[model samples]
Target: MNPIEARHWISAEDKDLKTVSFFHLSFPEQRAAFEELIQHTPAIQVYDTIWQQLQELMKTRHPAEKLSPDLLQQKAAAHIGNGPADEYGVWVYYPWSQRLVHILDEAEFVEMRTSRNQHKITAAEIKTLAAKKIGIIGLSVGQSAALTLAIERLCGEIRIADFDTLDLSNLNRIRAGIHNIGLPKTTIVAREIAEIDPFLKVTCFEKGITEDNIEDFLQEGGRLDVLAEECDSMDIKILSRQRARAMGIPVVMETSDRGMMDIERFDQEPQRPLLHGKVPDDLSYTTIRQFSGEQRMQVALNILDYDNISEKLRSSIHEIGKTITTWPQLASAVALGGAMVAHVCREICLEHNIPSGRYYVDPDQLFKL
Candidate 1:
């Protein structure tokens, strides 16, 4: 397997890239010798891109003046951790591949990886995002949003909470394969983010948020910039909102029907009702916890606003514990949920007014006659 594609190793210690210098030959005779070495070991083919990249790095560092071949080689060596291939080369040992791969330093790696997001997110926005922390609870639909946020570099730090393990059934909307079965959703999501950018700080709560740990999760790292609440547990769903409101953290949630998304700016309106009054302030955590399956379904329906929910979802509500096992979700709706939450998060973090209200990302309405 390609070292990059080796999932287990990527999550392991070898995940860190080494600052390996590109092989530079100043003289024609040295070039011939290096070419001879490459011929002997085809394993060096991995460095071909790095070799080309070094030239570009040299040009960037000396934009105003033309650098001589020797000076370019010298600078490239220093920039990439100046040393001989085996001697000074930064190398990471991948146990899976049983190969030592040379890789870029963290700074260059992040620069090239995120270079494409420029101007749209803008340099200033990117810098601001790097200092922000985002928290996500429930890894099913929230997994989609977490990844979207990570891919866009919306925040430098992310706290993910989910106690459930990946089941075969979750493949429909949770974006995990059979290989991930039995693994905690938090682990899978954290590993995926690490693979995308190892420098990103991801803290996983293997156990879903509870009253015991909610305070630490929200305020442990100076309070979350935003909270995405998408858990199946009605108790957590409500409890998290309370914590978010108490901490003055904005909250966002997406329901997997009619593309319904809700954003509550607790920071702006601290007294706003949790879930817009659907979940009553008098509703005790103990009461929510002891609710029967049917009772929980009613609570969920109430929060989604029974009158405004899509007909399809309204119909499915009756099937729970009857004709079907649980609430139905489609990959399409889950992906849309991800997009909706990520967009709202960016706006809130950038100090924009997303407001406290429920909005539909209704695809049916958008494309209808």
Candidate 2:
């Protein structure tokens, strides 16, 4: 193949991960498609564990029915039309990985996969969360937030935006491998979410959020239920909240320092000042965009509250030009931020009273001697 053709092939493979294909053996055309796919895909890994999953589903469904083991097996078989066990459930094909996973259909799959959530999440809560949509910007710390949200099945759809590509330096906090370097941060996060739960919808904004596309990101498909702003761009940070407040959508941000998490409930108080009024009224996106490097850092520090930042971060900020090129973030802090953001987003989506505020989960302060 020519260079152009090879590039096209690689692009097609990358795009293939955007969706998953499912085949139910009960349908003749679908069965044929599945057979053809496996036949042509060399060395494809096939996994068949539908029978055990079905058994578990049966146990979950009839916890109070008290059926015998044999009776439960018969019930599982009967629910899927008493078909052969081999032909049961649906076959999920992951084209990027060349693997076919045999599992329950969407309904049963979600039921069994989230069964452990139980009374903690409740069936009603799960259904409610399934209807929510979340938007995230800046995939460094945002990567953790997105993955944690997906793993928890917090929302039905997630829209992630990050123009920056993965770098060797990103591996310290971003959960990506060396091979993913040069790939867009949005793509890495989206592909990881797809792998975890193919049923969840993920939209990627490869160009990142800009003045031209910020509106579309927040309202095009549907108004975002929550916006997680974690980008490094100060201008975009202020711009996103401005737009989100105008649209009355809530925004959440994790600074990865002192375990600081910021939630701006724009939906609750549409007129609320940005960053809880940390940003002065005179400061606008256009003005901030023109600031010099030192000016930008000062503005960011002021927004984050210089007095509240951890000592390590304050020291690191001083070392930017001398010892370090930028601010330092630990994997531990990033991971904690991801979980914190996910929890806060979940609460907001569920209509809980998570008011606009700044909270910290600092380990040093919590576990001090």
Candidate 3:
């Protein structure tokens, strides 16, 4: 194949990439596999930070008591059966980056990584959050939310969906590098989460959420504790909520404009109207799918409440096909939206009393004199 075609072929393969692989060196078969990986991939970069992590783990376990260097070393040695440091824990391999990391096993690694989140996120709360599963439907603002959720180790499993691949235009708001262009958005988010904590389960629906698969996405394996709906598709925005309400799963959405966040506590009030009744119950996905471009735009505006939008965004709406190609989104807004969604998701999973309604965290208004 020509070089150009070959490049496209490689990118397509990347879209099918899987989660990071972990091998426990204590097992003979896994050790053999690691040896084979290193032998064949001579240039693979290896990182062994297990010793440092062990030190941190020991300190966290004995915060009130002071242990000397020798005592700490002895404790660490006993914790790992006094085996060679390299063979004590799991070795994770990242195929995309051709790098290998040696770190503590799942439980120990998680303890050390989230030790700082102690009082802020209590021990009982951590266990409760870990058992929860979250589903995210879009990859633009959803990317930021997924990362924040992963970093906080807020959920044990995350299901992400997006049918689009990375493009140059997405660089303005999506948190991805140019090298990722053409890779599926779901793949990018899943891979990043794996790098953060390989033990966390991530399921990717590369096809994005559609009528045929929406049910499985919400109910398969286990019902999601919360759903973060950030997709722009009007049908999905409405259809997903309909399904979530039926399953009694709460739904949270963040529009980058003015950091507008909408929460539908369907779990608490299964009969809560979709979008706080902003969307008519009579409106079906079938009808929404066939709406003309102008009609669809009008529906979207109604959902967002045009009167409440920032003046600049309201003005930009008229220039859709003139000065701009579509609605404008800035990196700052997307990042803020991610944090907002994550914070709300965590609260909902913890059963906090966040009511069903629309809330805005507009920086412009907050910072105004």
Q: How many pairs collide in each candidate, listed in order? A: 0, 0, 0
Worst 10 residues of 3 by lDDT: 1-10
Give me the candidate number with maximum lDDT.
Answer: 3
Candidates in order have lDDT scores of 0.75, 0.85, 0.87
Model 2 Cα lDDT, one tens digit per residue, 1-369: 111111111122367645567777777777777788888998899999876787788888888988788987887788778467767777777765788888877787788767888788999999999999999998878999999999999998888888888999989999988888988887778768766777788888888989999998998878999999999999999999999999999999999999999999999999998999988755788998899998899889988899999998988899998999888999999999999999999999999889889999999999999
Which candidate has the top score in TM-score?
3
lDDT of each residue in 90-185, candidate 3, tens digit only: 888888888899988888888877889988999899999999999999988899999999999999999999899999999999988799999899
User: Which residue pairs does candidate 2 place in steric collision?
Assistant: none
TM-score of each: 0.79, 0.92, 0.94
lDDT tens digits by residue: candidate 1, 14-63: 33321112232434453454456456654553322464456566666566
Pick the winner on TM-score between candidates 1 and 3: 3
- Candidates' RMSD to native: 7.5, 4.5, 5.3
Residue 34, model 1: lDDT of 45
Q: Least accurate stretch of 10 residues (summed lDDT) in model 1?
A: 1-10
Order of all candidates by TM-score, from best down to worst? 3, 2, 1
